[model samples]
Target chain A: MSTPIETDVVIIGAGPVGLFAVFELGLYDLKCHLIDILDRPGGQCAELYPEKPIYDIPAWPEISGQALVDRLMEQIAPFSPEFHFNRMVAGFRKLDNGRFEVETDEGELFHAHAVVIAAGGGSFQPKRPPVPGIDAYEGTSVFYSVRRVEEFRDRDLLIVGGGDSALDWTLNLQPVAKSVTLVHRRPEFRAAPDSVNKMFAMRDEGKVRFEVGQVTGLKGENGQLSAAMVKGPDGEIDIACDRMLPFFGLTMKLGPIADWGLNLHENLVSVDTEKFETSIPGVFAIGDINWYPGKLKLILSGFHEAALMTQAVKRIAHPDQKLVFQYTTSSTSLQKKLGVK
Target chain B: MTKISIVAFDSTRFDVDAENGSTVMENAIRNSVPGIEAECGGACACATCHVYVDDAWSEKVGSPEPMEEDMLDFAFDVRPTSRLSCQIKVRDELDGLVVHVPERQA
Candidate 1:
């Protein structure tokens, strides 16, 4: 294992709020190292609704979730916050000197004076389907997410589930795959009306096949699928397919955060509104992962909390440095620090 | 360039040249105007950039899209003239536009 990453702060979650925390903490001259379970930043925004338009942001009337994340990435560019992606924080403990040490599931360790829990709704993991032997085909013929569209090219793809992901992949993979079959236990879909309608249209046009059933069995050897046993209303039917896409949605768990010895209410970390610090000093919580009176679980609300949290974080990180309230607009020192000159 | 006036909750007003293709949020951040957090960097994902369009310019600023309307529901105080600054684009026709930033965003 590599040496533990030493920094002033270790911010868990690279969502909008966590990314903003980097800017706030950086303003106080604190270096930050961020870790997220997702392979990329933006959390739910990039993972769930990258293209969905949002209208409530204070300045812009409307912006896509992905664009918001991109701009934030740019805004925080000057901070150079380090990110450890595709890793889950597995261990957290207070060091003897009052600093904190955090370890990831990947065995990477991080040491910091302050720890900020910006994880929004915890980590998102795909709900595994109930089909036995499905795990045997995972990473080869069974996938929860379509990382690359070309991977399904020329293959027989059978997509399961009634949500957006199933319908979306059915529609997207229809043209590329040699054959596309969509299977859902219910006729009613929870997907967007537009996408559901388009999927039906494609099915009616013979571009895709629709089956009402649940994948009950997987037929494959060494992770290569040859067929799937589907349980329809009539009976079990076998569908020839090389790939199975199941979109059973995601489950969010507090995970190791709950075991860190912090006070928790309703599976959320409780913190004070002033410093947003949890029961443990040197450890703070913000964003949806934190709960406080009158707390609105909004991205900007987390941003404001991050701003206030950093003041306390600065005191912890560098007790010798005097804290000052300065605006990025007119503070020449801040401007110089940000390399704005 | 067009000129836009952004008034903060304290009634502190800032008049800056608005870039033709930039959104009002961009102009506020560029001028370092307070009260407009633009936390998501103008992404409509958060309500930090909430602003009240001057009554006279409400029609000129136009109405919020359905998606924007859904988001405005989360703003601290929603008003007929409350608009997300990020959604309003700057153009020659929007010159002299004035908006008031809320004391605190949602």
Candidate 2:
């Protein structure tokens, strides 16, 4: 018999919820293997706008998405798992031995006893539209969102996407970029009113020029996006641009887990309230992969789900040990020992 | 109060009484709907209050502000029906609307 690769769990996606699961898994003294496509945790938060404000997560009241991610990484840093960065999960296959083997886009392989498909939204795919020769500018000029805003402090940017993401980025880079030109497929804007009003204001100010069309083609000459071709209402035209920030929004393709036959709710994975089980046995789902009663789907909500699911996984692994949650009061315990309030 | 049904991924359905004034996110958070966080306190800055406007009721829920849509990019499971729960006000049209939460919030 082959020796089994034993990890208490393998979590996919390093987003806020996935990292929170890693934190929760540590509480149970379980060794886990965490994987993410992005180079770091925080999922879309880090991938998109790190400086953006976030209010819903429990605690901290109000914090930027990046700051929240920092604190979350801090909470999990103490019990860090084996991290696999820049690795995209291709899919998973259940072995005959009741374990799982996961494959990634990098051709790496991992085996774990339990798998928590924490892959959130699956948007890190950076759903840039097909540009004829955009790949030629990979290292030099053509780009997705501005990874480092400082580098493009004064450079001209050609942005795509009429939705909220596009307009918001335009407004954000208004003060930063030398100039901002926005392109949209439809005449209508899909974002909220505040952003629309701001864009209109920017237009009146001549800070931004809105093109009512879509990006048809792009060519990177001299390691830069020198010519941006678009299909606008007026006609097809090429505009001089230094870089292209396509904010068309990432397309999330739910991975192989969909084949697991789990109960679903409106195309979302469904989970039993008590056990957090999928339609099949041995293969369990948690966090965003599976949903249960009163599922809030927030970071705090996922933490609670992970906490309870960890207990369930532990029971499945070790049926004999009675899992009793021990609420901790570090300050209280220290006070009793040192005779201090 | 208009009656609304919010069936979360957990399959635990909530039948809430939405008034004519408060936003959908506020009503859910106030009534303790299992999923939406609505963390920004109704400000469009926080996308935590994300919810999928049921396909059938999409028009009734209207659309979100540009900020809300931008914030949604950070949400876990964003779809065409996605809307910041905070932006969707509970009105007569929103009556009997249903929402689904994403895998996680930002």
Best by DockQ: 2
Q: How much of the real interface does each model capture, measured as fnat?
A: 0.00, 0.00
How well is each residue in B3-103 modelled by candidate 2, as lDDT tens digits?
A: 88776767777888988878877777877877677654676755677788789998867776666765664554356788888887778876678887655
Segments of candidate 2 deviating more than 4 angstroms: A1-4, A89-111, A219-223, A259-267, A291-298, A330-341, B1-106
lDDT of 1: 0.86
Q: State, as a TM-score between 0 and 1, how close model 2 is to the true structure.
A: 0.67
Give the per-residue lDDT digits (tens) of candidate 2, residues A1-341.
23434687888877887787776677666777878878887887787767666777766778877887898888777666778898877767887877788777776777776777677665336654555566777657766665677766787888877666777788888899888888776556777678889998899889888886656677666666777888766778987788778765664456555555667664456777666666655455566546666776666666676777777777766678888665435545433332344
Candidate 1: lDDT of B26?
89
Predictions in order: chain A TM-score:
0.81, 0.83
lDDT of each: 0.86, 0.71
Instruction: Flag regions of model 1 displaced more than 4 Å.
Output: A1-6, A37-71, A85-88, A104-109, A121-123, A292-304, A318-330, B1-106
The lDDT, on a scale of 0 to 1, for candidate 2 is: 0.71
TM-score of predicted chain B versus true chain B for each candidate? 0.96, 0.90
